[model samples]
Target: MSLDPDFAILLRASADRLFFLLEKFASARVLVIGDLTLDEFLTGQVERISREAPVLILRHETTKQVPGGGANAIYNFAQLGAKVLAVGLLGKDEQGKALRSLLEAAGINTDGVFVDSSRPTVTKTRISGHSRQSVTQQIVRLDRKSDDLPDLDLQVQISQYIKEQINSVDAVVCSDYGDGTLTQPVISAALSASRTIVDAQKHLERYRRGTLFTPNLPEAEFAVGYAITDEPTLTQAGQDLLALTQAQHILITRGEQGMSMFNREGSAFHIPAFNRTKVFDVTGAGDTVVAALTLGLTVGASAWEAAVLGNLAASIVVRRFGTTTTTPEEMRVALQRLLEEG
Candidate 1:
């Protein structure tokens, strides 16, 4: 299916404006605070079925570690040309060191990332099995994360960092995977920033008074404890969330259904997902969206315009495998391609 004719026309008309916003990303300074994680991919060649069990034996191929969770958001910001500062917790382990090295290699400032020896660095490992001549297929995943909070004193240090640095950046982005890095004190500290954008896993209400927060449809349903089965229900959920969060804007990301935005002023806009082609993987797509959206807002784009950039950015990342980011050049080409195909 194609987009509504009206939307296609609006997007076509504003294509140039969107390009201008992308060019301005270099000047924005962003602060990201949340749970940092390392996403590991282990790929091996599928050999034969195991004699002792109904399992396939595999020959090891290669391993990869990429920024994930909030770290991905930081990577997106840095990739998109913004000067980025990251604040979070990491374990005093090799994963933590590797994750920090990756962040620094991408040019993200990690001075605010503190070490907590009590817990291990958060990691998500995806194991894949593949034939010698075929694409790798993910077989299973292993997760190492903690729900326990950092020491109260450590939280205080993080809060103090947020307070001191929040004003220096153009915006503060809180990426919460509910890993306890964003405790109440930390959230309060981040809220002090005038422009705060959040990508939270749950408890959406805690980001009250934020400039914007992006939650997918399932998260919305879970937070409200109701299904958004129709337009009326969706509208009510939007209003309910706006009131509950006291945010200036709420963007509900509806996967393939597209994304809808609601503001405190009672106006809403729906942007169709530009998934005009195959989607290989959706890993880190939300991070790309929030990164582009926050940078757009920082550079003075209207909410709708920023959402359009975010949407286009996601369209680019989902076409590839693994966690990745898109550049301004890629976004421009995507817009033109969408127009040609639509």
Candidate 2:
């Protein structure tokens, strides 16, 4: 996409402000409250066809695991140098244990992470195929999760935890992936206590009166019960969401097309996606956006500035693999490169 000169100029000045905000992330405190998940990736080389079926056989090369879902939001904040505390439910299983260890080792506060044995840790196992000629690609995915919400007792426990810790954080991030951790009680606790930046896959209305809503195009469409096939429709969708959620800001994240944000009064701001040619994976890009935006808002950035920072952060993370994150130094490099190219 060609940069509009006016927007390019704005990007230059805004990038400078974002550079300053990046410096304050080390001290910014955020509480991530939502579903906790483990993302597993099994990559292999397709060697030969299977005899039993018309399927290719894979020579399994490596298996990798990482924090996903709401855990990914916590990981993003930690990677960006924020003091992030996680509040969610995990399963009493090996995946949960490994995810907890990863969070603790990364210096994230996992005091609010609870465990239950009734269900397994919300997990997604992606199998990727590689060949001498083809690019690495996910061939199939396996998901292990239940649609049930957390139990009443567990909900109360999580709500109580949020109430206690909300006052300590600069902002709260509710990353709901419909994995039973974000119950009405828990969502209410976070929304009632602090400024919440939400990234939910569905049921966006449950997160009403949020400080900000960052739903991708399809999620927004789901919430509004319509198709957004053009700019006018997209704008209407933003306005509809703003009314439905009563949020101060609404940011509809359009992959490759960038982001479109609307305010309480229905004023809109659109940002183009960056570094499109370098996108390698988009698994955890939303978490990356919410982490950067929450930190930017905590450090006194305007909504547009926060969204730009998110756009930059998303740009960086998508160039990597799986549920990953980007650092301040990387943000700086990206910004500098953007400015130079502009």
Candidate 3:
């Protein structure tokens, strides 16, 4: 239920080293390839009930756009001082324009982003309403995307870009959201690079052996075809996931219970949740984990140590709404506080 006391001490004592590793992010290049989405949050006030329908009218207030999916992971990586190269598809539309501007403002390299005329930039809009004294809550959501895959030319361009960029980056992160960007060719090209990590919604087996797979508890259960209600079952689930995916390492993120790790050789480690504080929002927490964990591995941290850093990163991002990111300085402070409190 808690982190080992000695392990906590070690984590604390290595604070400087951890920060040093974070600094290395500036030099280590990571390629993020997959679904690039624009997340729009519209916050308004509940005005009155509609005359013709049961819905309540909302007084328009403000709208904000941020990165989502693979874009969010790239944002997290950039926030942590990593040199991130983003490779994905975006439509030649306003949403795509805004998303690219946001990424560029965050210092993420977007030259690899393919602009396909056939698809609209994937956009998820969340409408939140609040009374004068009540907290805002999401009332509805709308998604805009293209159902078809990228045209042949666009697909070929994406694959060629991956091949060209693969040899240069320190690590490759496949942030698949079942979007067309992460096609089989893209995955194959990315896996050809060194130290590839995949965070997918489903079909874990697509990524071949030696890849690192990060799937949350429910995702793992779905992939492994069972319930993971206890430690033993969780252990077995991790084992099953590794064998099913043919991955060298598997990390199962368990929200409050923390994260569980497994490798091909049968070694497993469970990292307890870093914070005892209330979770404000869990949107994009998985992206934070994938970002921090892959960054850790890029810097040569052990599987368990990387998971610990990821656990800490997730604890920070969940305290905010919409897609958010954790910074290196924030992580250092949180880890230090976790040590002192422990």
Candidate 4:
């Protein structure tokens, strides 16, 4: 597809703005709230089929673990030089402790992370073969978390911490993974505190005042209560979500088709995904996108500019094999290439 002439100009403008924004990221502070998870990857070789069943027999291999979901988003922000504070519920377990250690090692402030003794830490394990193909998957995904609002005592503590820190931060990012942590009350408290960016795991109408909504196609459809089969429908859906969420900006991630952004002003822009040979895994791409968007806005980039930066950041991560965070340097290179091509 040919680039829109106007979009070309916009892209050029965004590229210029990115240079300044990149510097701002070093000094920006962000608050992250939502589900926290442990992503475990077991890498091995599938030697042959099992005689007992039509299944591949995999040999034992190396194990790798990373903080994921909302925690991962916070990690991405911190890695990009942002002072990050993360608030989420974790079970009192070994995995939870490990996740906490990982965050601290990465320089994320975990003062807001609370322990839910009623639940176990959520963990997703993927077994991949030598060829980097996922051979099996298992989730010890624990949601023993209560849907009930956070403990009154804990909520009071969290609210106090947020009040003290909110004004000092540039942005707040809600990385909901359909986990019970991000309740209506939690969102309300966040909105009352700072400029909020949300990456919803599901359609949440109550979160309308969010500064930005980043939902993939399916999530977008769910948010608007319709199937997005074409551009018109997609545009309408974006508008519906923007209105419902009271958000000024909506970004619908279209996978292979790239992404489209709709602003409160009734203007929409689409940017195609960077051409790539293959997609290995798309685990943390959304987190990276939200991180980039929030960071972009903190540095004074307009909504459109932030969305474009998000697209560029996601393009690089999708081609990787597992949950990974994109660095600012990587984003800078991608933006430079896009501009040089113009």
Candidate 5:
């Protein structure tokens, strides 16, 4: 797709302001409340094709683990220089322990992370096989989670934790992956707090009267119950979300097409995708957007500017493989490069 000429200029003009906001990230405190997860990757060499089956035999290699879901959003905020507090549910298993360790290692406060013995940790393990001459790619993924609702006592504990920290942070992020932590009580407490940004997979409408809603194209379509194929349809989807959820603003993320933002008062605009040349993997790109947008609001950015920062952050993460994060320095460099391009 060809670059939008006016969009490039707008980004160039925002460079100075974006830099200032990034510098303010260090002083911003954000509380992320939702489902926590551990993402595991197992790497091996593709030795040969199986004689009896179509599967390829592999040589065992290494296993790596990182934070995912709400944990990943916290990672993104921390890497961008924000002081982060995370609240979520963790199982009393090894995966939960590893996830807590990863969060603590990043200097994030996990006081709000609760442990429940009845459920298994939400863990996604991906196995990658490769030959000597090429980089490994994920062949398959295995997920471990609890199908049952968490104990009522556990949900109450999570709700109380959010109420305690919501007042202390500059902003709150509800990163729901349809896990049990984001129940009605928790969502109510979150919306009561100031400057709440939500990125939820389920119960999108249940969250009402919030600062912003960041949903990817498909997520928005699901909430609105229709296909958003073009500009007019996309605009209607955004408006419908705003009316349904009553959020102050709605930002629909459209992968390579970039994003569109609509406020409750009928103001709307679109941002073209940035750094489109080298998108290797889109894993956790939405997390990057949520992190950047939340931090932008925390630092007093307008919704439009926050969405722009989100676009830059998403652009950076998509160029990387696997689940990862982007730093403030990286964002500055990206903005500067775009400015130079013009």
Candidate 6:
């Protein structure tokens, strides 16, 4: 699909405005609440086959760890120079301490982070060889969580914290990775307190008014409770989600098919994915999109402009493997290049 001609024109006409808005990212304050994860990558060379099975054995050489999921969203905003406050549950373990330290190092406020002894901090491990192919992959995934809503005391604390900060921040982003941080009580607190944007990782019905919900194709389908295989069906699904969530807008990330946005007034806009020579890993591309969208809104960009900025940001992160965040300079350079090409 080609870029939307109207959107292209809008970008050209508002280039100066967009630049100004993006510059305001430095002053915007954002609050994020959701799942926090640690992404571990083991990279090595595939030089020999396993003796027991017909499998390539990787001689591991390097290990790297990065913040992932909702924490990644917070990191992205911090990279853009925003004042970010992150609230989530973490276990009392080495991984949890490391994640907290990482957040602090990135200049994110960690006051809202709470310790939960029941669950170990979530972690995802990936093993790749020199070929960048999955030679052997194992996930030490653990979800020591409960679905029961937060207790009255915890709910009160969360509500009070939001009320205290809502007026100070430009916007709130709900990065729901289904880790249970965004419980019903938390969603209710967000709804009653401020203007919010949600990355509906899986639970869609939790959305409410004064919020924007961004869900990928599979998530949108689940939100609408049907199968979406074509443009028309996808459009219908978007409308259905808008009705269900009563949100101001719904942005559906459709991978290579690009993304489409549906507003409360029933209007929709589509932006095709930027053509990339290679796509290494699309792991945290959605986080990049949601982070860009929240910051764009914070800087006073229109919904359409926010989506465009988001698409541009996602285009950059997917080219690299594993979880990653986009920087302000990178976004500015990419937008400038796009304008020059046009």
Give the alpha-carbon lDDT of every model.
0.91, 0.89, 0.87, 0.79, 0.89, 0.80
Query: What's model 6's overall lDDT?
Result: 0.80
TM-score for each of the candidates: 0.96, 0.94, 0.95, 0.88, 0.95, 0.88
**CA deviation > 4 Å runs, candidate 4:** 1-6, 46-59, 130-152, 276-279
Off by over 4 Å in 2: 46-57, 131-135
Clash total of candidate 3: 0
- lDDT per residue for candidate 5 within 217-327, as digits (tens), equals 989989999999998999899889998999999999999888999998999999888766677789999999999988898898998899999998998899888899999
The alpha-carbon deviation from the true structure for residue 102 of candidate 2, after best TM-score superposition, in angstroms, is 1.0
Clashing pairs in 5: none
Better of 3 and 6 by lDDT: 3
lDDT per residue (tens digit) for residues 1-342 in model 3: 245797777777777777677666566789999799999999899989999999989989999999998889889889988999999999999999999999999988998998998899999999999999999999999999988999878878888998998888999999999878888888888889868899998988888763799998889989988899998999889888888888889999988888888999999987777764567788999999988888888888778778878888999988887789988888888777777776
Candidate 5 off by > 4 Å: 1-3, 48-56, 133-135
Q: How much is 32 displaced in model 2, in angstroms?
A: 0.2
Clashing pairs in 4: 208-245, 208-246
* Model 6 spans > 4 angstroms off: 1-7, 44-60, 129-156, 276-278
lDDT of 2 by residue, 240-316 (tens): 99999999999999998899999997589899888766777898899999999889999999998999999999999
Model 4 gets an lDDT of 0.79
Report how far off residue 124 is in candidate 6 (Å): 1.2
What is the clash tally of candidate 2? 0
